[model samples]
Target: MTTGDRCEMPPIPLRSTPIKGFILDITGVLYNSMEGTDGIPIQGSAHAVNRLYSESRVRFLSNESTGTVGHVVGKLGRLGYTGIREEDVITPAPTAAEYCKRNGLRPHLLVHPGIRSVFDGLSQEDPNCVLIGDAEHAFTFKAINTAFRHLMKMKDPLLLSLGCGKFYQRTDGPCIDVGAFAEALKYSSGCRHVVIGKPRGDYFQTALDSMGLAKDEVVMIGDDIVSDVGGAMAFGMRAIQVRTGKWRSEWESHEIKPTLIADDLLSAVKACID
Candidate 1:
């Protein structure tokens, strides 16, 4: 279907922020569970992102920390998104790495072994901070307690969370995410954390910096109003909420509303560009 065939909502008159490019969320907005459905093109929902990219650079920002940038690029390519590159993708792990590098703060990282190899020039002793992201073993109380105890001793140690949902919905049921673990640490250790994903301004800041745009010119699109809309609005960017993935009937009652809402990505894009 063409752009006209898709949009169900009228595009609001945007005041125009410095967001000449776009910063996109991956999980619910791009793909679900990092897997591609049969016959579904990666580009299927990417029309608006591509349209903006044609005129401006589009960065495929994600919070997945389980794998390296190559893993993310491969997944996107398999889903039919051809524009993503290694540098375009950002995750909490990498963001933490960069933050450490720039600030000259080396922290002991607790990442999944798969992506642990990506950390360079860091060691286990006397680290400046404790960086936590997604880990296959992260759910265990033993793991959490161990990390928490170490954090308690550090002076002003910061917990950095890559984009992880507070709860994840799967075939079996809902489950806690690394953020909950981080929260537990906060409660116990009394150390503050900086989240680097949806619902947090830090993640948006990273995306905006990557896109080289101020908050106003960029548009935030996602399937979840809480993360996508709320997060984007917190950063002063226009937001479009898509009624897919995490969309439910009660979202209309939310205290914070999107600039516009649509049935799907196509409609959301139309609402933005039209």
Candidate 2:
């Protein structure tokens, strides 16, 4: 896939093996949160996703924390993708809670109230994991400092990251995502943070488990090479990267590579099935 807007392409190959389901990345692959790009219906995205649903089981997996499942479903409906159910979606936030519960580790959270809605089972009594989500306003230095203080005191606590974008593609250039703050905190605290979003294998495994599908029967389709392609590759599933989203050919020359690159989601979907 090359940079810049290119010509329209037809649907790509579906995998030769029967595709039990698909795990999708929401932000760049399905829809951009910000409006007003010369948005081209994400070429074959709706049709391919719908087609997959009609043909076999399909799951829409994302790392979005800004909205709840209902909100996401509404947005997807607006985009003309109607095959998904709320339960079919998977995110690291809820998964992390389950992960912690399964491991007998409760974590104290440092995230905003709105973001906590994504994780369903947290109670005040449970030990908290420092949960961070994206907010519209700037975080005060004092607040960050306080979080750092807690980070210093906790022993073997999990630092869970909400999938905040690292860099966003804008009219000017790539700008930092709020998640970069979380990244910085993880570095300063010398605590290993498990990023549950893109590029993380946890969400992938969760989707596969929910679908009752083997890794070989699923293909991951997305726009970002790191979150979509890298994550899928790590899970031993095939990946197809569309030229859309954060993957500019020149900017990220060697940092990440896709198993297959397509001009758009439709072409990418076709590749996945082939």
Candidate 3:
């Protein structure tokens, strides 16, 4: 049954990234969207998380802006990932909020309604920058136009995009992600945009800072090649691309290769610990 045409692919290989902090992607790496809203856990993922706790300070870093950090923790618990605290989970929405606070830039929010509370304390009176996340249906023309107009009015005209992911897979199909919206606004407003989520070095730095670890001491694990693997590597950290999520065999020869590839989170974690 084995194909002779294949050169050779191993089950998993040990990565060279030293282990102090673990940065994991949520959507495809932990659980998949096969069973509706509450996605079914990928096999061995919970076990991998358990091992991560014993070995390193793990942070669930995701581009997910659909729900609050609290919601992500709850979902993790339901899916049998225990000992995870709210602070351990980082998403673009809250990160964006913190970015606004630090920079003293009031943002015109273009994010999901569920996570709007994250920006509650931020000044909205005179929004100077446009903060765009995956607003799902909120990406309507009126909304986008409003955001565009706001950006046009701003003297600086800055757009803070959540993540530059082009699309995400839903149960129905793949839908346009926040990156697309960010690009659209960028095109219209010609504003200087900063991506706030995965593949953004700052975002990974934020996660590492939260864990009190330097980039050299941390390893990023995710299913996405570009976001998880490519991003972390670019940030000067070791990255392990998992076979589960959005991974494809053709991408094995991508320009930005991972430090090593693993069969899944369990394998990726094992490589970190063992």
Candidate 4:
């Protein structure tokens, strides 16, 4: 947050329990989302992460529903990161698609076109489900109305929401996230949407599994206090909130407090290992 590419944050104190794995949030935690379809890496974050790679396993758990798993890995490398692996990255799109396949539900997908391919094999012939993600500008009135009609008319309505965070940070400014649109649909259709991404215990468990660590042996580092800190705590794991990305001062008073709060990722990494 100090400015430019690098941060000037100092190392922080640590907790007694040893943390062997990390679940990281991409957008606001690692870098500031910018134009050109990628983002800028936050100061010292790349270095801190690389250093952590020497000590512990890392899994990038993001509700960033846009890219394929490979693209997620590429995005990290393009942002100057070196320690992340393809399987270490977990996004909601593919996971949601797998859910649809497992449940035999054909989703009237309201997701971004970028990740729309993941649901390719599934039958959208008679979409009994409505799966929503960060569709950005694609959430037209017609689109929502169409999806609403699907849910209202279905014998059993199923709405799978990718993640429910209200908004995320971009270099220019803040923009509405998937949760806002998902809520609107829920209110209009009177159908409850199932959460598919962060804060969801199963999703956290998936990330935890990828790390081969139990909940107590891992730490969740992210920006959104609700989905990241609150969710991780609810899953019985320690969580750390960084004052970057979509971070707001008002959230500091939120009911769910982080195990520790830091200025940015650099300090969070230091605290993770200290």
Off by over 4 Å in 4: 1-14
Error of 1 at 114 (Å): 3.2
Stretches of candidate 2 exceeding 4 Å from the true structure: 1-18, 35-41, 104-106, 119-121, 124-128, 136-138, 169-175
TM-scores of the models, in the given order? 0.81, 0.80, 0.89, 0.93
Better of 1 and 4 by TM-score: 4
For residue 150, model 2's alpha carbon misses the true position, in angstroms, by 1.1
lDDT scores of the candidates, listed in order: 0.67, 0.66, 0.84, 0.86
The residue-by-residue lDDT of candidate 3 on 48-123, one tens digit each, is 8888887668898999988899988998888788778898888888778888999998999888898989899998
lDDT of 3: 0.84
Better of 3 and 4 by lDDT: 4
Question: Cα lDDT for residue 202, model 4?
Answer: 93
Worst 10 residues of 1 by lDDT: 34-43
Candidate 1 Cα errors over 4 Å, as ranges? 1-19, 34-43, 46-49, 168-175, 200-202
Q: What is the lDDT of residue 221 in candidate 3?
A: 90
Clashes of each: 7, 17, 0, 1
Candidate 1 residue lDDT tens string, 1-274: 1233544342334444344666666665665552223224323576655775676666665666777888777877877777767788877677677777777766666667757766776565777677777775655777777777778878877777666466543323444566666777788888878776677787787777877777777877776666678777777778876766566668765666677777766676665565
Error of 1 at 88 (Å): 2.3
Candidate 2, 1-274: lDDT as tens digits: 3534633231223454566677777666765545344232455678877767776677777766655677777677777667667887765567666766676655555555555665556563444456665543435677666667667877764566766566655444555665787887787887767776777776788788889998778888776666677778777787777777666766344345555677777776765554
Better of 2 and 3 by TM-score: 3
Alpha-carbon RMSD of each model: 6.2, 5.6, 4.1, 5.8
lDDT of 4 at 247: 91
